[model samples]
Target: MSAIRPAAVVVLAAGEGTRMKSATPKVLHEICGRSLVGHVLAAAGELEPENLVVVVGHAREQVTAHLAEAAPGVRTAVQAEQNGTGHAVRMALEELGGVVEGTVVVVCGDTPLLTGETLARLAAAHGGDGNAVTVLTAEVPDATGYGRIVRDDATGAVTGIVEHKDATDAQRAIREINSGVFAFDGRLLADALGKVRTDNSQGEEYLTDVLGILREAGHRVGACVAADHREIAGINNRVQLAEARRILNDRLLTAAMLAGVTVVDPATTFVDVTVSFEQDAVVHPGTQLLGDTHLAEGAEVGPNSRLKDTRVGAGARVDNTVADGADIGPRASVGPYAYLRPGARLGVKSKVGTFVEIKNTSVGEGTKVPHLSYVGDATIGEYTNIGAASVFVNYDGEHKHHTTVGSHCKTGADNMFVAPVTVGDGAYTAAGSVITRDVPSGSLAVARGQQRNIEGWVARKRPGSAAAKAAEAASRESDGEG
Candidate 1:
């Protein structure tokens, strides 16, 4: 492909997308971490055009808000009325100040699978052939809803395109359909759009009419057939959206596998476009790696795990866990059923076991927080063992506080640490204790009350019940022994 930059790239997103049945604009619907229009803009941005414009309508506020965050520098044009594609491009041209001399590439916002490489090829072909207009076309098994490309029989030149609604039975039989994507000579496009009339069956101006108008003026018109028809697929509803997502995910996973990442079950392992993996990283079945998650070499995430905006260091393993905005250090292990919330950090060789939840806490190297624990807003030092069913009671009504457990500390099972407290290095806390005060180094802290047994309580409290009957039987046995 030649290094030809487009003068302007106009994205047609102004359609109401009635078929989508969505309150959100069709172009704002997402697949694989990117909205439909966002994907199109990304591909168009690859051309490095002097001007990039998105024509927005029908929920423009939502789409505009998205663009402000996602692509702040790109310009937008408004199509106030629900006109046709021709009117949408006309608005984009007006936004560009109507002075474009180089190649102008136009693309539909709904086509997420269209690649930058293909767009570049279209632009190159348009420029190389000196064509007044060049269309991106595809030959499909079904042309039910697409525009049919009509070509001259003898010269093989494209004559015009007919929308499926207006196409005759003979023309509808043509397998080669217009993709609604084009690369046009900028000045000629502007001149031809003016001649387009709202005389079609839908009473709207059709961009396809421009091709016919330009051809009538003796200008060369060409069509570039896409290699894969799937690349031209559009998303209008939930079903198509899901299908597109599957295709895109397959592509992403295949590329990752080719790059040396091990995906145990590609079909069941879902990954976002923003996720990255180092060589030797393993993702097991039913795992979803989303957002900016990164897995270092030798990291293993398993059978039912979802990690979002998290980083897993080398040699770490996360099993059946759900983590968000967390960091797992090298050689660390997390869960068969753990939840790691934002700001949770596990150090080297650390372990967070089954049914544990960690939030806004840091577990030091060699530390272990075993099953049935909730550690929140706390810091635990190296070589420490946090026993099962322990709770870091860091919140009290209005404010949140922090707890600190020092190096080599041993916290017993069912222990609770009250916030603003500290356990010094080598200290031990007794089982079932609630430590409200700090413990000095090398000391044993016990905050639990002495155990006492209440005799005959069950008999008095529950007469004629199973527990009371059992107590009476035991009392009779005691009397016999006496």
Candidate 2:
């Protein structure tokens, strides 16, 4: 038998996903912070395809945009209309232009959990057996909605694929179902795809029809049964999307736990596919780590926190916070209710308190922002203390400015530093102050309204009227008593 030729991957992603009920493109809907197509593309990359072609429709622009951002160098073809799987592949073939000879693996974009190993195994079986077509099959208990694979009892070769809608009672009883993934001789696939017709009940060109054509043409069509049926599941609705998410999460969490990461409650802790954690990194329940997040050894993550595209250094602790595009250094402590926006960085041993928000700012080592503060577009030196209710008023409606606080500085509660101000090292701001200018090193700045007393002012305003009214009331009461 000839060796398996290098294969090109064609991912079908043209389904409208009407059941999903959202404006977002179906393939672009995320599973663990990654688009469904993104996951499939990563798996296909493992096979080292000579070329990768993704058939996009529905929201073509949105799907292409996401693919461009998530996986560069991937080629795309537009399926202008919602069509059957066979038609989708034919649309993608236009991008290949002339005829080429190799294996062509066609897979569904929504089956994100299809692993690289399974594809490799399928390709090997196809080439080793010299089959003209190889179909990946799984024996699912509930195959009600899937296409049942009809095999010849003697040869165990796939004779046909009967769609559930058209299958008889006995055919529906068969447990083996077609996964819609196929590895075919490139030339054979190109030839067979042209022969497919849209005479089915749905009035769409069916890919399964190609199996019968291959069979009648004296070509050997083979089927490889997958060990796990879940590998073949596809996402078309929100319920299935959630199921895929749970499965993916379980796979990642299991791998991490085996690698020495501590996941306290895997059920409630959601980790993305690209997230990594070192040994002894403990993740608490209700924590969601997404989008290339990393936690170093000894780091601890929350009982209710969400982190994305961020890094947490060793020994850092994050709890009940929402952080994105931020870095927490070693030994730093952040939030039971803090918000760390993009570009926020906390140095080693730094502390961010409850209700504090940090945006586009950096806090030096040991610096503290303790409760009820907004530190945006600012830089704080080491060991500085930002008191409760202190704010770096960074915006003036039209523009944003920066505030600088030097080392060892302290700001009292309710202090407001209007932007374009600086507090030198060791400076102090009194409580209830609104600082508008720079304060030199070691100086104290107190800006507030002066206090005044008005004790007897109320008594003088109602002076003689009080005694006259009292005597008049006494005389009236005496006359009434007589």
Error of 1 at 41 (Å): 1.2
TM-score for each candidate, following the candidate numbering: 0.95, 0.91
Question: lDDT: which candidate is best?
Answer: 1
lDDT of each: 0.94, 0.90
Report how far residue 246 has shifted in candidate 2, in Å: 1.2
Candidate 1 regions with alpha-carbon error over 4 angstroms:
454-482
* Candidate 2 accuracy as lDDT: 0.90
lDDT of 2 by residue, 1-482 (tens): 12343558899998888888989878888888788988898888888888899999888888888888888899998889877888888887778873548888889998989988888888889888888889999999899889999989898879999999989999999999999999888888778889998777888888888889988999989988898999889998999999999999999999999999999999999999989999999999999999979999999999999999999999999999999999999999999999999999999999999999999998999999989999999999999999899989999999999999999998899999999999999999999999999999999999999999875554466556876566557767989953
Candidate 1: the clashing residue pairs are: none
In candidate 2, what residue range of length 10 has the lowest lDDT sum? 1-10
**Best-fitting candidate, measured by TM-score?**
1
